[model samples]
Target: MVRAAVVPAIGAPLEVTDIELPEPGPGQVRVRLAAAGVCHSDLSLSDGTMNVPLPAVLGHEGAGTVVAVGDGVAHVAPGDPVVLNWAPSCGSCHLCALGEVWLCVNALSGSGEVYARRADDGTDLYPGLNVAAFAEETVVPASCVLPMPAGIPLTDAAVLGCAVLTGYGAVHHSAKVRPGETMAVFGVGGVGLATLQSARIAGAERIIAVDVSPEKEELARRAGATDFLLASGTTPREIRGLTDKQGVDVAVECAGRAVSIRAAWDSTRRGGRTTVVGIGGKDQQVAFNGLELFHWGRTLSGCVFGNSNPSEDIPVLAEHVRSGRLDLDSLVTERITLEQIPEAFGNMIAGKGGRALVVF
Candidate 1:
């Protein structure tokens, strides 16, 4: 039996309980989790902001050591330190064939499938987002596991699976931000900070970080933002002011709120790009003038996992982490145990810190 934080249903408090993890099936690998990042998406899954079936183990950003591999598994071996890929692409999919693996059609195809079970009743448990890293042990497709370099700390590497990939991908891939260009990032959370750091790595001339929390300013600046502003009604104006009224070349929405989404669109220069990296609630809506779509010639695009191909991008990010170019260490503010998930999530909802990891 392995212990896990299980969400029995929508609106239910997370229950820490002993669970049974089955042996990995063909092409699958079993991971003994070293750390799992407490992400907003996990909170969303728990609170119903993001929809997933109930009685699921909720965590996607994780790093661990491989304990076992099933038939046909050859990429990794036992005791290998690795990060989990929540959205693993099946190489044969049309999107994958087109080299757009981030949009792989097979991603999330196993949503309601079971890999763990209730120890007491033997009821099947769903693996949320297919990775299920909230548990002490998780079984995932071999494609979901990526080997980590020897020097990268597993605890910090846990976030590279999601937060780093998403934010970095937004700037490096989705936005294709060029050197000397201007960039504005909305929100100063993990992904937002990663976006900030990526923009800095990309050599953006001016980087602006916006958030409602004043405490985040220091961290934002540390992540490479040249200027930090309190998000408010006039934030777009403030961003424009910083960009000489031209607005930023690339504006990214990481706050996952309708207001911030609108602000991101409004803060981009004409013919510039706006990338929405935040996963907002389904009902939330943002409005824009119909004519601006044509008149502004701006590109408003949504990013999933930063449009990253984990197999290829994770290694590059790991190297960045190794060279001190990407600051994953600074992003980690707190480390707790699985039992403290509720409190950790409370702090996240309260806008308490950067990235909190559940260290096993």
Candidate 2:
């Protein structure tokens, strides 16, 4: 038996309980999870903000060691450090074949029962996304597990699976913000900070960090933001001033709110790139003038899985962390235990901790 956090219902903290760990089925691997990052998406899943099935295991970003492999699993061995990727690529899919594996629609269309009991009495619990890393041990398809470099710490590598990948991918892959260009990022949380630092690594000349909370500015500045915009009633004007009155070359939306998306859109120069990485509610909508939209020629794009080809990008990110170019350690603000996931969600709701990691 292994410990797992189960959210039996919506709007609740995960109940840590012992779950049976059986041998892997065909094409599956059982991973002994070492560390899991508490992501905003997990919190959103638990709070019913993100549409997810109940009695679900809530974790997608994690790092662990493979202990057992089922049939046809030759890519990984019995003891390889791997990062759990939620967006697993099906190599033969149309998106995958186009070198856009991050947009693998075939792999994501499932009921998310990657791990469950096989008996009639077993409750069918859903695994949020694909890789449910909230459990001490999880069984998943070999495709969902990506091998990481041995030297990187499991805790640090855990976040790279999602937060780091999304932010870095948005900047480097999607927008392709060149060196000496200006970019403004809204929301300075874990992913936001990663975007901030990624812009720095990409040689972005000016990184303007925007947040509703003033306290996050200090950390954002340290991460690489050249200026901070504490969004008051007049954030658009203030941001305009920071960008030489022409708005930034690139503006990224990370807050997952409709207003922030609008802010990010309006804060960019005409014909500039506006990248949206935040996952907002289904009911939310942002309206823009059709005439302005046509005239601006502003390229607005939505990024999932950071436009990353995980097999290739994860290793590159790991190498950056190893070389001390990208600062993964600085993004970790608090470390919690398995039992503290409930409070960790509360802290995230309150907009307190940057990244709350669960060290197993």
Candidate 3:
């Protein structure tokens, strides 16, 4: 029996339960998860904001060793250290064919459940995202697993699947930020910080970091933010001052709040791009004049999973971490077990940690 943390209901703490795990079906692989990062998306799932099915095991960012592979699978064998891709690129999908696998229209295996429930007498358990890493072992599609290079720590690699990849992809792929360009990022959370570092790597002349927390300012700076804004009174004016009163060339919104979205739109330069990376509500809507969108030639874009093509980007990100350029080590703030997922998630909701890893 494999112990798994289950969110039996909505708007509540996750209950850890020792449940049996079934073997992989055809085209699936069973993984012994080594570490899993607690992401904000999972918290959103619990509160019904992310549209995840209930009584689900919540975790997407994970690294593990393959224990078994089902029939017809030849890519990876047992004991391969692999990163679980929450968003797998399906080759047949239109987006995938266009090299935009992150936008793959099919979410069945890329974003939804892959395992079954035995306690309920063979009832299917909806797995959160493509990989539910909060358990000792998870069954996933072969496409969702990526073999990691030797010597990279699984614990650190766990976050690379989501936070690092998403952030890096957003800057590199979504906005195509260039060196010496001006970039401003709103929200200093994990993904936001990753975005900040990517901007630095892209050689942006000025990278501005904005957040409500004074504590995250230093971290953001270290991650390559040249200027920091704490969302004080007259924040727009403050940002305008930093950019010669012209606003930043690119604004990436990592905070899902309505106010943050508006700030991103307002802070972008006349012809700059505003990329929305954060996930928000279905009912939430932003107000913007249609005329300005056309007259200013300003573009408002939304990217999911950082517009990443998992097959190509995941390995590249791992190489960045290996070269010590990505800084995945310092990005990790806490490590706990599956039993502590509730507390770990709570801390994330409070915006108190960098990244939390659940080591199985």
Candidate 4:
């Protein structure tokens, strides 16, 4: 039996309880997690914005030590520190062939399978996003385990599994913000905060942070924002005002709200890039006129998993972490126990704080 946070059904409150974790089968690995970050996607899964198998373990951002590996699992061994990659690309996929592993179609095919049972009822449970790191222990396919980059603390590396990767990739990969460019990150959540620092790492001349909460200005600045703005209808205008009538060169939306998505687009200058990483619901539609699209000449693209290939990118992030260029510890606003996951979800909903990590 191992402690885990389980979402029994869509729209249900998370239950912090015990579950019977099976040992690694062929092509599988069992991990003992050091920490897991409660992410907005988990909230999306719990509330039906993202759907998965019933009674699923809900965290994907995590790092742990491998305790066991089944046959053919030669890449990792017992005691190896690893990051849980919730979306592991199948090498044979078209996207993988093109070196765009982040868009791999086979990445999440395992989410439909049951890997655990409820301790109380023996009911089947799936591993949410395939890694199931919300639990103290979980068994997943060997593909989901990536060797942790050297020098990063095991607990802090959890953010690298998702938030940090998404943040870094949005700036460096999706938006491709160049050195000395002006960039703005909309939203001050885990991913948004990481993007601000990533832009700083990329040598952005001016890094703007926008959020609905005024309290987040300090946090944003600490993460490398040059300026901060409270979110409102006039946010884009204010950003343009700061940029001397020219908006930011790149704008990344991490808020997962339609307003912020539109604002991010509106805040970018002509021929700039607007990358959207937020997981907004269908009802929250963003509109753009044909003339505006033709006039601005800006590119708007959706980024999944930060458009990151985790196996290849983690090493770069680790190097940054080692040199103090990246601050993983500062991204975590609260360190918590498994039982506090529900509260973390509430915090995300209330638009409060940065990442809340579950230290096992």
Candidate RMSDs in order: 1.2, 1.9, 1.9, 0.8
Of 3 and 4, the candidate ahead on TM-score is 4
Model 3 residue 133 CA deviation in Å? 1.0
Global lDDT of model 2: 0.85
Taking the tens digit of each residue's C-alpha lDDT, what string does model 2 give over 1-360?
777788879876578877766698789889999889898898888878777667778798899999999999988989899998788877898878898888887765543554664133466677777777888889888888988775798767888889999999999999999999999999888899999989999999999999888889888998999999887667777888987798899999887888889888888898899999988887669999989899888999998868987778878887888888888888889888889988888877777757888888
lDDT of 4 at 310: 90
Question: lDDT of each model, Cα atoms only?
Answer: 0.91, 0.85, 0.83, 0.94
Give the Cα-based TM-score of candidate 4 against the true structure: 0.99
Question: lDDT winner among the candidates?
Answer: 4
List model 1 lDDT by residue over 211-287, tens digit each. 98999999999999999999899999999999999999999998788999999899999999999998898777988
- Please give, for residues 98-130, the per-residue lDDT of candidate 3 as tens digits: 877677777545445536684645545778886
Task: Tell me each candidate's TM-score.
Answer: 0.97, 0.95, 0.94, 0.99
lDDT order, best first, reads: 4, 1, 2, 3
- Candidate 4 yields a Cα-based lDDT of 0.94
Summed backbone clashes in each candidate are 0, 0, 1, 0
**Residue 139 CA displacement from its true place in model 3, Å:** 1.0
Top-TM-score candidate index: 4
Q: Give the TM-score of candidate 1.
A: 0.97
- In Å, residue 59's CA in model 2 sits off its true spot by 0.3
Please report, as a residue range, the 10-residue window in candidate 4 with the lowest summed lDDT. 8-17
